[model samples]
Target: MAAPGTLRRFLATAWLITRKDITVEWRSREIIYTTVFFAASCILVFAFGFVKDGRPIDDVASAILWIAIAFSGTLALGRTFERERYNETLQALMLAPADRPAIYAGKLAGILLLMLAVEAVLVPLVALLFQAPLFRQPVLLVALLGSGTLGYAAVGTLFAAMLVRARSRDVLLPVLLYPITIPVIIAGVRGTAAAMAPDGGEMARAWVSMLVFFDVVFLTLSLWTFEAVMTE
Candidate 1:
């Protein structure tokens, strides 16, 4: 077991990092607005292009929703760390005496909160625009969204940190992120689609379970590799 003082320091460090990122974000408000607007526009474009004869397919709604989230999330993750890289704050943070994993956790929490905020609006907009009966499977929808977002953020945070100093980070974030996160994305779309289906309860449960499993695994992997990647 860790000593009380050590535990307190760890928690305090994590909180301070989170608070710092939040404070920065609150001041600028750039990422929140950009991510939300980008996601909303994607949803509107899909609605316009795919809503056939004044009606959209229920099956397509889930796919569209996840796609919007994925794209916006990629953009948000990249920018979150890019700010640190540009300002040279990431190196300063690394040079601090705080725990490295705490820095990773703080960053992960900040990015996750931003993405969730974006999802909060985007989910309902997709439902409204596509006429999806999303509320019918409230539990399933919440489970899939939470797990999918958690897993995506976990991996995205690590990769974004790694690519922070890269020249082509804007293009590379998605290229590296998507291939690894395909399982989470697949589970998200499948779980969402199943929830929308009339007899897809069992399948939805399976996909949600897979999402949860993936979240645990990927988050563990991120935490394990974060310090090495950040220091290298």
Candidate 2:
């Protein structure tokens, strides 16, 4: 239904937005530093609490990892939007002569990258602290993690952008985000657990498939609705 050249323009616009976000973030390091530090703190606290009971960290490692990402990622998403709002850049973006979907894609990409970086640090720390066999199937774990992260970022970016102009946005962001993202978190934790199991290949595959489905459904929906949501 769209012109052929539309896609190219959309992509170019998206790339520009992504580049701008990354450039600003690289200079300040505020989002990254806060996200990683919060995530690492969560991991350490959980590690200490769980060890008091002499519980096997492996059993709960997957849940802990997802928890770290969910909370830290939420924080990072809020900060990303706030930065744009504070600089009045979001208004500038809205007036630009680019497809709205491109803007959404760029925001999603930026937030997703931040979340993934947080995960990278958290995952290694989780493995080191909990002695999880996370690297046993590094590719599988990464795939599972990526799918879950993508799904979260897709919905999170949409809600965050929509709420950026609202009062109590920080309060509302997690409240709305968590309800929608429960499935992704569940799939991630279960898939990670399955991947860690000796006979979990088949189970992990099933969960990853669900993660993929969630990613596709939410991502497409976000792309479709971003224009209306952002304009409203």
Candidate 3:
């Protein structure tokens, strides 16, 4: 067992990395804006192409929403590590005075925060554009989305680190990430759609539990495997 101070220091290092990533993002504001734009475009395309049949947009709203998130989220993940790779900062991070899991946690936190921010902009935009009832059960929806996003971000961050050294770094993250993330995405969409139903709270709760289970399981697995992945 680690000492209390040792654990605290580890957490502090993780927090520092998380803050650094957010600070860099705040300076540029590029990733959030790009994600929002991509998300908006997805909404517009789906609205034009699929909403013409006078069908309830809610029918496909969940799919549309998650797909937008997944696609745009991939862009954000790819760019997350690009700057470090470009500037050779990753090597410096690897040499920092902290355990490797701390670095992984920080990167995961950063990616998760970015995803949440995009979702913040996305949910309202989606609701307004499609007239979907996303806001009907905000609390449950948020809980479910948060869990699912964290799971996705966990795997995404690890893969980002892995691909940073690859020749096809940009192409590799999603190719490796998306297939693994499908279950989380499905659970998320189902949960969101259930939350939209008249009395879907029960179903939503079940999905939220599933999301939490997925998050915990994968987060632990990712943490344990991160050192190996990063060193390779």
Candidate 4:
């Protein structure tokens, strides 16, 4: 690979960080098992309310899906940075020569990857359990999940890093995170609902467009503030 421009270098650094996190998780199987289990268990618990005598109540699948994503995502984000905090590497990472935003991007990417893995299990289980035709509009569904998760991960990555130095980080993460990400969770739920709607995914396109726009805005704000946040 040629080291041509700043973009290449940034991406290279981000990938290295992502690979490191993933490699560690692969060896330990901690994040994956924990996230997936939490997400799955969330779905099963909701099964009681959503599933009727034999079928799921109308429009429940979308709610269940997003709830699982949000809850499990929080778990992944907290633990992802906790490793850095516990290993005493976060300070060194902050002091590294790389752009702080790039480091943030790398951590964000790793969390998103872990969440996606959890979603892979969650989505299929949702379809099977609730009989939600989630695959009806695969492309649209993917867009909603991708953009929504991006928005969620963008904010989460920042907060988890900031709270890495705090004593009550685990307690503080969801408190700080949920209020900002409600829009993301709502967009994801709405778009996903539209995608599986019998109306032929008409409104899903609009929601997808809006969610993508939100992703851009959230990521911009998060990246811009990352350096300042980490400095303290």
User: For each candidate, what TM-score against the reference?
Assistant: 0.95, 0.96, 0.96, 0.96
Question: For candidate 2, which ten residues in a row score worst on lDDT?
Answer: 50-59
lDDT of 4 by residue, 1-232 (tens): 5356888878888888889888999999998999898899899989987788878898899989998999999999998898998878989888789978888889889899888888889999999999999999999988889889989999999999999989999999999999989988888888899899889577999888888888899999999999998886
TM-score of 4: 0.96
Report the Cα lDDT for candidate 1: 0.91
Q: Give every collision pair in model 3.
A: none
| CA lDDT, every model vs. true structure | 0.91, 0.92, 0.88, 0.89
Clashing pairs in 1: none
| lDDT pick, better of 2 and 3 | 2
Q: Alpha-carbon error at 45 in model 4, in Å?
A: 0.9
Name the candidate that leads on lDDT. Answer: 2
Query: Model 4: clashing residue pairs?
Result: none
What's the CA error at residue 36 for candidate 4, in Å? 0.6
lDDT (10s digit) by residue, model 3, range 131-191 = 7899889899889889989988888888888889899987788889999999999999999
Tell me model 3's lDDT, rounded to 2 decimals.
0.88
Task: Arrange candidates by TM-score, descending.
Answer: 2, 4, 3, 1
Residues 103-131, model 2: lDDT tens digits: 99999999999898888899889988888
TM-score for candidate 1, residues paired by index = 0.95
Model 1 Cα RMSD, 1 decimal: 1.5
Off by over 4 Å in 2: 1-3, 53-58
